[model samples]
Target chain A: MRVENYSFVFAVFFANVFAWNPTPQVIEEQVPQTAFAQLLDFQNAARPEYNAYLSAGIIYLPLPSQSALLTEWGTHNGFAFRQRIGIWLTDNFDGKGSKGITFGLGWFGERQGWDNEDFLFVPNRGNFSQINQIHSWGLTIADSSKHWLFGGGLQYLNAKDESFRWWLLGTWSRFSIMPNFHKGDLQFINAQLFLQARELLGNENSWQNYLPDLEFSFYTKDSVKIFVSQNIFKQKYYLEGAFWARPQDFAYAALKFYPDPSRLLLALEATATKKDNDDIYFGGGITLPFLRVAYNHADDYESFFKSRGIWIVEIRLAIGSSGDSFFALKAPKAAPKEVKRIPMKKANFNSNNGE
Target chain B: MKSVKFLFLLLLGAFFSSCTHWLIDTETRIQVKNSTNRDIYELSVISPGKRIVLVPDTLKVDESSNVHVISWVGKFKFAIFVKNLPDSVYLGEYELKGGSIKAEIKGEDMALKMVLK
Candidate 1:
């Protein structure tokens, strides 16, 4: 039954993306990004300045951990989505940051038309499921405030197993605490939330907007990523790097060009695979206000990653209750106008209506 | 004459030592014991952030917070922020060789007595 609902969501998502509509991207402000949900909603992972956000995309890679591949069940390639919202107890404290708790919801699993690839590449998997029905959903919670942010997230799947990650960060330092970063770059406190959060939301819409005064960044599930981002060449481009001492970590040095801070972004990145030998994966992504498109490719289908290549499409949305509502990805609308008018009469009870 | 010369040298050394003590900063452990007429409402080891370590709960008179080891050179400042008293109190910069300082709160009027060892 759960899988059936998943199939329906997939259908609707495709229809919304591929089908033509009269609505244009300019009116996104009035529409509120989507009546749907997004990535941070912790993304305390949250660098965390938003009231809400939603991120969902399709990945071309399968789950590639020793445990994920050889455990009781092998995972499948499918669509991935992350959604989160901050229930602000006190919002935009001291004018820049907020105090709140963040709740997250997301899923990863089989796409309806896509073929089952769970056992196609595995060897000696006489016991593995050939039906290719692998799926996992995650729930996350974190304390999101200007002073501190921490998260504990768990993933549940059809297989009889669970993976849990605990994330904590102290935001006061305003820079990375760990030493393995490019000089003056920011560090990551929670990787799960911000690894993609920073990319999905961009610099202006980041949680940094809610910070009391300074900036910081993220790490990932297995490794840490240090980022140094600044607007250069008269604020036309942004550059950030993930520098690490160890070679077995996923690292990237990226540069992005944008005409406006929010409307469009083009990224050129040199991504590294965790495989021991020195090999770089180069890819780029193009971002619109609420949608992002990127291409993915493996290393000749022979290296640590499998399968040569595929394209990925993701939706990213972020909006906060405080600060400037105009930049909301469909942020909030302008405040209602005040009007004064003459008083009118009260209505009488109608026979057809029940009191 | 030799005894008189030694006494003069000793006096000169004493005066210079006291002057240097006033000039430099030092590191030491800090312990606060609530000895005031009223309990302590807030305690902080503030620097970049006004880190409030305690709240709502009272540090009643004669009860002390845990011993905080000050490992570096900075102002050993603190305060009690009750609603009626919005003003915070600061303990002046301290210089010590290699010991600890115990702050004894005497009253609600913010009379602080420091015992430096």
Candidate 2:
């Protein structure tokens, strides 16, 4: 099983790379060559550029609660660990306008760990005292235009160990409020709103009913990007801020040398809450093509705002698309003169699904 | 008039400072009744700002225990777990006050339920 899973992941990665390459092809005029050629002939046009993404990570939080931050330090601290994996496939049907459907599947599990500090303060057992697992599947339809972007989806979540399940309905919309600001390069400041609600199914029940997230993004020409978002989960509100930068011609040779300066990305983020009951997290991550690694530290009020010698590490692998266009690390160059097709709409060119 | 204003400001500051003590540690008594046929090796209560082990040893079937916890006065969501049990039960958000909170743990045909009163 493990070998099959590894082979599947590698195959998907190789296929994505092959599909994205803009290679020249020679077609025979007299005879049809193969089944693949026949399939291409049936479609007539070239294959649409689609994206597939897969991410997996492990989170450790000593203290566990509905309101507890997954990476926060101090309060209700316990040695608990949870692992999650998610996969998504999306493609656009209309050129220039990103009209597409996204299908996703996810699984998550938590493993309970024993408390080691019980002797310090009688009954001071660290938090990892519960086990919960979830499996989910989702489908979303999305459309993007010059002024508006919108999507909505229905997701099903089932508890692995209990008779609990729910259907979550979520919708999101983004609007480019103002015209692009040109300071040597063009940039746009955009705002987005996301909302989701859940309905309990069967006999089991849940506490949370709704979730909402609001965000604003600032994009410029291959320089820096700033994003701010406010999200609510489990009735607890959280605020996050991020800044990203990509420099030109930065490459590391894991094997052969590659000239994709845009493959390198550096990002810094902070996620916190207004209430002191939860810990705040500060972290940064770097992305290299198909891989990403991040580390974050949680500061807690219960521990006098100090790290309890704990760190959270997150790693992800994405197969479908490249990084955001704003972090391309190079300014746009003049289009090639021999243009056979009408230029793709600027709206699609500016859209960065990888962000 | 200036003296009166100064005195009022001082009194306001004192009141606000005293209110901060409202979150001082208080005793919370949790009563757990294991109404099952098998022994429970561990029973732990997991809350946002508090963690307390109600049963450190084996709690035999049909036994009850009153676990005393010291924490601030507020509502807490309890993530309760039993030893060797694959699943955990959640006692929805409840306020911690002077009275004893009761929870009955019962299972039938491999289905577990923790009813909080």
Candidate 3:
């Protein structure tokens, strides 16, 4: 069998054991019970005037060596599983100008699985039986007032194996100012910066560093948004444009045909130093009641564990205490006071009837 | 022969001494649903090392009313452990009634509605 095929089979076996079966149980047992549940409910509420959300996903990458066997004895080589969770704190979480200032925290863990003979980061190329595990955490803060949205965050990562240890510190910040333009078209200017530091905290001899990233996005209308970003230091640049329809639930069958609840996105990225390495990416996806799927060319497999590229598929299954209400593709518009007041009475009436 | 041996040693040393590491960012979303007949009055997310202190450890439910009101707030601290690092964690609240749930953090408002499954 080819290397990729063997990797797929091994991946399926481990995936069945690790990713699919254990997640449901873990989620069920870990569901919170208290004000936190209320916070989650609020975050998930449709038309959340202001809200925050926290989520986690895991990605797996199998090594090529795992596909080939030695002798007749079949030995399975392990793959890398990168796990990440993020808290999306957004003021005006509903996207309506109802609230401001939201904070989020994201934490991640990446484990590199390799056999004793294949371990790479060893002193004097020594053989190490243990695998390497890395841990990282990030925090994002956004403050959105009447006309402006500003946010920033940092990430710290530490990795260790039998032979060596490494550490990295990265920082990112973004500012977006929305200016009142002519009818229906909202114009905005955005700026972003990213910086990173790498060091061998344990051995001290092995170290490297990089600092690159900046970009801007312009929201022209409800259906059109354009952005350009570049890493001035690294001389790399990218342009991206996206078109999305107004949000509508499947229940509103007639309304669906009007806006076409789908998205088309195009992006091009190139390195000034080596423009030949440039890559162009195009993707389109749909939003449905049961699942959400999207395809993208630039796959962040290393960071997100998910694939990105020519043909990528993303499938999400909505399973939580709340049903379709939890995942809002876009913020909901504000409801008038009279409309808001009715639910309070309805809740009270339900309680009374139950009694 | 001596020069060839020296070149081989240099290549081996260079390969063993150099290392590279990649930094990645991941996002996870968690959804919680309430199926019980009773209104879920409160929700809290607790990490492995954190303590939850409820001013009143218990709730008093009115025997004749199905409404549940949780009116208490306490601080909890989460400590990072090498093995217990969680990718994402969240707590949510839902009013069994057909209204929106709201959480305000740093002045941002997030509203959600509860749907009966």
Winning model by lDDT: 1
The candidate that wins on TM-score is: 1
Candidate numbers sorted by DockQ from highest down: 2, 3, 1
lDDT of 2 by residue, A244-304 (tens): 4332321111111112212223323332322223344343334453343333322121111
Preferred candidate (TM-score higher): 1 or 3: 1
What TM-score would chain B receive for each of the candidates shown? 0.47, 0.49, 0.19
What is the CAPRI rating of model 1's predicted complex?
incorrect
Runs in model 3 with CA error above 4 Å?
A1-50, A60-76, A89-153, A160-296, A300-355, B1-117
Candidate 3's displacement at residue A219, Å, is 24
Please provide, for model 3 over A1-355, each residue's C-alpha lDDT reduced to its tens digit, 9 standing for 90 to 100.
3546655744553342322111122222221111112222222221112244444333322332222111111122222232333344443444444345445443333333323122233412112122334333334343433322222222222223121112112112122222222234332322233222211111122221223222323333342222232222212122222222322111000001102111111112221110112333333334343333333322232122222331222222221111112323221111112334443434443466545
For each of the candidates, give the backbone clash count.
18, 6, 42
**TM-score result, candidate 1:** 0.34
lDDT: worst 10-residue window of model 1 chain A = A65-74
Report how far residue A278 has shifted in candidate 3, in Å.
Answer: 7.2
Q: Select the stronger candidate by DockQ from 2 and 3.
A: 2
Q: How well is each residue in B5-109 modelled by candidate 1, as lDDT tens digits?
A: 575466445422222222222234656677666656565433334544422335676887665654332223444543345665544334333246665555555
Candidates' RMSD to native: 31.8, 27.0, 30.1
